[model samples]
Target: MTFEMLFVFGLLAVTIALFISDRLRMDLVALMVVAVLAVSGIISPTQAVSGFGDPVIIMIAALFVVGEALFRTGVAATAGNWLLRVGDGSETRLLLFLLPVVALLSAFMSSTGAVALLIPVVLSMARKSGLQASRLLMPLAFAALIGGMLTLIGTPPNIIVSGQLRAAGFEAFGFFDFTAIGAVILFLGVLYLVFIARFLLPQSAIRETGNPHPTLSVFTERYPTAKQLHKLIIQPGSPLNGQTLSEAAVRSQYELTVFAVQRQGQFLSTLQPVLSQTRMQALDTLILYGRDEDVHNFCQALQLRRLGFPETEMMKLQQRFGLAEILLPPDSPLTNHTLKEGRFRENYNLSVIGVRRQGLALDTRFIDTRLAAGDTLLLAGAWEYIRALESKRELVVLETPAELQEIPVHAGKAHMALSIMLAMLMSMTLGWLPNLSAILLAALAMILTGCVTLSEAYRSLNATSLVLIAGMLPLALAMESSGALSFVVDYLIREYGNLSPILLCAGLFLMTSVLSQFISNTATTVLVAPVALMTAQTLGLNPEPFMMSVAIAASTAFATPIASPVNTLVLAPGNYRFADFAKVGIPLQILALAVTLALVPWLFPF
Candidate 1:
């Protein structure tokens, strides 16, 4: 290989390694790669930064704000609720409804944005319905991928391919050009998940057998034959006041089993055998399970309640509308404050339900455990109060709603967003506006409409992706400019020279698929488009077919999280391991590849 080729290849290798490792943030890594390329003189400063001005990148950023606006307006949440209601308990029905919805939304918005908006909704639904989250997340990711393939703005890959095609002297793809093939692939993909995936996919939610708590086991051990039951009351002055059964009891109290507790307006646990002499105070509740009613009664005598739920409209409203969770940030004002002194509920309208420390759940007397940094408080109150808490310098609300009021005023600028997008697509497809100008206009509209504010529009844009594209575009240009692409094309034609055009298209499709899994889809398209162009030139074949192959390959990145942001978003919430993706994604990949390889050449003949 020539020194330039070797250097380009090495840069690609480093980029791949950094992406896979994920030790640094992706944008940071992308920036570093740009710097290295510029320093190596592979690309100029203008080229290195030119990607920042790319229309595709701008559209992606604007779309993020639009998606966020939808989320903030409760539109996405409302849709999620409706979908869940329709889904009910049937997996097939859920898939049937979800796949199309995700795909459609992703086509207009972003796959990452679509997945992020859906994940929490899905997780909440899963927990409520007692279904495994793993079962739903993979489908969500796959659906986003399928949806993104449907439109030019659906994913970055589509835009990249369109830009490359424009550079190669062919008409760029229209907004809906890929829809037919994409729809077919999407339908087949959803069908595979609905009818076939259940049997092939493993039950990934296996919990650890047996309790991990030694102290809790003490009661069971002592009452080996005693059928133990124990009880405790929230005494008016005792440390057990205002705590739930699940959060109380750190170390074991003899052989007593605290089976259940009752609090204001709620039963903490269901189904407990009634015990005699079960007296509860206005502020006190019971936590008892023991064979000997006498022993249970004895244990209740030692507790006291320190406070009572105040009788006030504000308190009642606070109870009704607010949900609170303590975020243990390294620098929180409440870190050292006790519940009473902190005035957590009185001042902030937040009621602490439980504390999570190092994964252990605690609900003891408010003052029993000192609040520490990194302890997650589970609070319950109004959503507004939770939002207000987030504004506090010290507290973070993890589950605050994306409210419409928070949406930038320009969010209603969907009309402008769509118009600009259509104009860009048409310009490229008709060979009127250059790819760069088309994208720049679309981005300008986004800013003008306030769909994305000037600051947000600029901030949300991925400099790394822009830099990667710009720096790599020149290398791709150099390869073409220096006749390297032609040389490679000649070699390929000589080796597979006798193979039909159909097979060549298939090869390109498969190669793009594999490269996409390990690199940015934009990078893959930029790298491969030149070679496809050269091949078309040498064979006197229609370049459209070859370019289409690259487009399909660039987008069919379902096998790994590193391949797509949508997949990564769902990983933690779905509680999915890496293997879960391979299980479902592999089949989808094969299906998409098979369809693309067979269909591309037919649609645009060589």
Candidate 2:
């Protein structure tokens, strides 16, 4: 080997060692690779840093925002709800629904995004169905990996391989070109996860170091007033119509708290926070919390009709409003004063629905009761107002309901977000715009339409993953520039070229899949794709099947947590150990190899 080749190999060994040690973060290790390569003069410094500006890197970053907008607008959660309905609390049935849905989503969006969005959903499904999260999370991750094979934009590796084909003076693989084989793999994968792999997954309970987040049931049980929620609509001739909440004096006159108002929209109803200046309109649905007697009297006195607050309505309330516990500090200015006397509603824009003293519920009219130090108050209001309380010095936020984390922030814009995504997909499919352009446009649309805020879009970008990808791209360039990639390709051909074409394809898949278990699959494909193409040309066989095998193998990152972001995402939540992945992943990898060898040649002539 040339001196430069040896140097590159040494650097790679150290990088892989650091990755395995988990001493430094993956992105930092990647940066180290870039620095070493730039300093070694294998590639120009400008080339070493050029990967940061690659279209693939930018597209991946943009994909994060697009996926996050889908999450924020409740588009992804709606799919989760569909799973809930289809699964109906059966573990076997849930897996059947969860795997395919996640895979199909992964085909269009980022696999990491699909898995991240559904992690909480699967956790919820587990909680509701009395199933272990481990049984579902591993399959979810695997399905996401397989889903990447469904579309060219599904994962970075697909794009990398397609770009490689284009760079070699060939027409790039079209959208849905991968669907035929990917669909077969996903089908066989779902069946394996449901039957064979299901038994292999560990059943460990979710790990918790401290107190877990309180659920809605826990709060409703502790604070009975929460169960007294009711919905009332004002009649046309009602006294409340056209009157501001301040003028209505809802708390004092009717002994009821208007948490929010359900206003009718052009096509749907929207929940608006009940601010002091919010005017009451005829037919406005008032969401109230109070005694049953008060709700009945208020409806009768105001000529309003009462509506049932069913479980679905309560779920909507949970999504639109925030319920949390706050403790009054000893130095709080409002201490020793009743809520009404302290003007709590006027100052904080939240309603104190229940009070607990010394761990006992005070079974009195909480509005008239004086606050005390160390007393916990159950506050109900819009999420924005509740979040505002975080900066208040007088009160300490004790806990928030778990539903708060799962609530969709931009549910009203779901249609807009979905439309943007569809347009982007159609543009890519019809060749109206480049894949990167479509992704960037969709991401920008997400922010412009308020599906996700600018800050949220920035926050949604996974810096570790992005940096890792950017940093590694330079190393691939260094390997190719330094003749290391050529050396490896030549060595493989000398030993494996004489083997049958089918066997040669199988070997390539094995090598790529094994490497993917330790490094980012995108990087794996970057290094292996050139070798596959070169080997195919050298052997006078078609390069298409070889490239397809490489792409499929890169996504077989199921055997280790570090193999793919999707796998690591489920590690802690599933309470899984290292062995948990291999128990199921290794077999899946072998099965994928078998499928690739059997199908790639049939689809793409060798």
Candidate lDDT values, in order: 0.60, 0.82
For every model shown, what is its TM-score relative to the native structure?
Answer: 0.53, 0.79
Which segments of model 1 are wrong by more than 4 Å?
Answer: 21-28, 49-53, 89-93, 106-141, 148-180, 193-320, 323-381, 385-490, 515-550, 559-586, 599-606
Q: How do the residues 1-606 of candidate 1 rate in per-residue lDDT, one tens digit apiece? A: 567666766666776666556576555665776677567765676776665665545544444444443333334444555666788767778789988888987787667656755664565445434577778888888888889889888877788778877887888999998888899998998999888888766577734355322221222232232122223445466544444332343223432333223555653322122122223334544433333544444445545322232223222222123233457687876777775466564566545545677866553434446788888775543354555775687776554322212322342454555555556556655668754565556566656665556676555444443444344444443444444444554565568745677888777777778767655677667777777777877888888888888887787877766566566556555655445667677888889888887777677777
Global Cα RMSD, each model = 12.6, 4.9
- Top model number, TM-score: 2
- In order of listing, the candidates' clash counts read 26, 0
Model 1: weakest 10-residue lDDT segment is 269-278
Q: Write the per-residue lDDT of candidate 2 for residues 557-579, one digit (tens) a residue.
A: 99877677687667666877656
